[model samples]
Target: MMKRYYQDEEDIGLFQRMQQDDSQAFEEIYYRYFLKLSNTAFKRLQDRAATEEIIQEFFVNLWLKRHRLPELKNPESYLQTLLRNSVIDWFRSQTRQDGFAAERMAQPDYQIANATEQQILYADLQRAYESTVGQLPDKCRQVYTLHQRGYSVNDIAEQLQIAPKTVESHLLKAHTTLRHLLKDYSAVTITLASLLMG
Candidate 1:
């Protein structure tokens, strides 16, 4: 008479057969582990639909990569570790996406706030602004910074030993270059740049 096989004996036999590419053994393993793996993932993710999707993906990858799977001293521990790592990766990706979305939503509001601040701070739009200051002719840049620091155009002209008309020309040229360079940005980028310069 043949002896009866215990369920654990059946499982070990299935596992050994799986190493030899036995489809039935692989299906048996899947049936045994799927519920436990899904439950573990669900505990971490909380969302039923997302948890189900994650577990399904995990098992599919497991089957696809079965040949490369390591020899396990404890198959259950190995599976649980894989599930935990998958859940951790899912949460990490969710955090990064949330941060990016928040930054995008805040950008326009940040621009608006910056514009309100810039209105009180500087005048002359060209030479007084940092973006265009660097692009000016060397003497123009020096005269502009003096005017930005509260010197009159005449005072800048006297201090730099240039004509007042030369100071005006430098300021105008600086402004024109800034407008050209910044034309591609939205109003928000302009405001933000102004705030940063200030």
Candidate 2:
């Protein structure tokens, strides 16, 4: 997955205040990204209780390490990377505790783990695509959806009673918007292609 720098001036200012032991700044940061981070964690872990625990631990650690936050360029990216690593560590710990040493040590099980990871990544990409598409203008969304569903531009224009050039314009607008919105999900292009083909 491509790392995203979601930090804007507000995020940076919050982190700076948090580094100074400001409780309100810490709370704001927590509320801002908590749901998003939790959703990402739950998608991978697939266990509500474990996901909550992991997320709580992540926040605790973030608080503990606030003094060093100034060194980081993108705090949101750091949170995402740390959460992903934490989930992987949780899986490994589960494997060890479950006495699956043979499977863990052997090479064959690696394929299963890799496949699961790929599925999780695909799920993330799909969510990003859907979310971004949902944000498009109404006409652009209709045009884009029909186009992706294999409708000819002329067909869409006919169905919507618009000129073909208008259809093309909406499509172009959708592409530009999606490209900007989904830049963080670089693999979404592959997902969209496969989805359209399928």
Candidate 3:
């Protein structure tokens, strides 16, 4: 699906274009990371079919949330985090299936610990996100909140009784302000800036 060479473009440039709904940028990201994400997933699950599903679902979700791409300062790490979450989700779902009991028992203790750590990190990130959003200007925060709740730009505009352009302006401002604040935030909390946007 990649139409042209975007080899010269940096990750940040690609992310910006993807946020604007550029299919080429999305394709570039997919091709660039697909193999790496696949390998990462295979390593954790060790099941060919499950690994493929995880990678496929990750790319689908990535495209669906392209509008939030600009918030990712570290695409590589963020992608890995996404895959890790997917793998954990797969494991959780499999746990409820009788066929997966033996496989779950074969999994290493370290893998279990890793999943626990991920859950803790996500909880902390959610709290930090709420706190950071609280610091935003009122209208900007409301627009961002509604946007995250799946409202389209026009929907947000009509609901807030503001012009669509004003709604867009508020979204852009919120992204910028949140990015700046997250950059200066603690390291453990910093990755949340990129991860929690979606």
Q: Give the Cα-based TM-score of candidate 1 against the true structure.
A: 0.44
Residue 196 of model 1 has an lDDT of 28
- Candidates' C-alpha lDDT: 0.60, 0.69, 0.68
lDDT of 1 by residue, 26-109 (tens): 655664555446546655664555665676667656656767878777777777898888899898877677676768646988
lDDT of 3 by residue, 1-198 (tens): 113456446567787888887767766676556545665676576565576567766777787788765587877788888888899999999768775666765689857875676556545545666787898899999998897665778899999999987987786677556555444322422232244343
lDDT score for candidate 1 against the true structure? 0.60
> In candidate 2, what are the lDDT values of residues 1-198, reduced to their tens digit?
222232222567788888987656766676456646766887786565677678777777777788976466777777789899999999988776644755664676786786677677657766776897898889999998897765777799999999987987786677666656544533423432343244
The lowest-lDDT stretch of 10 consecutive residues in candidate 2 is: 1-10
What is candidate 3's CA lDDT for residue 156? 94
| Runs off by more than 4 Å, candidate 2 | 1-9, 100-198
Q: Per-residue lDDT for 53 in model 2?
A: 74
lDDT of 3 at 113: 75
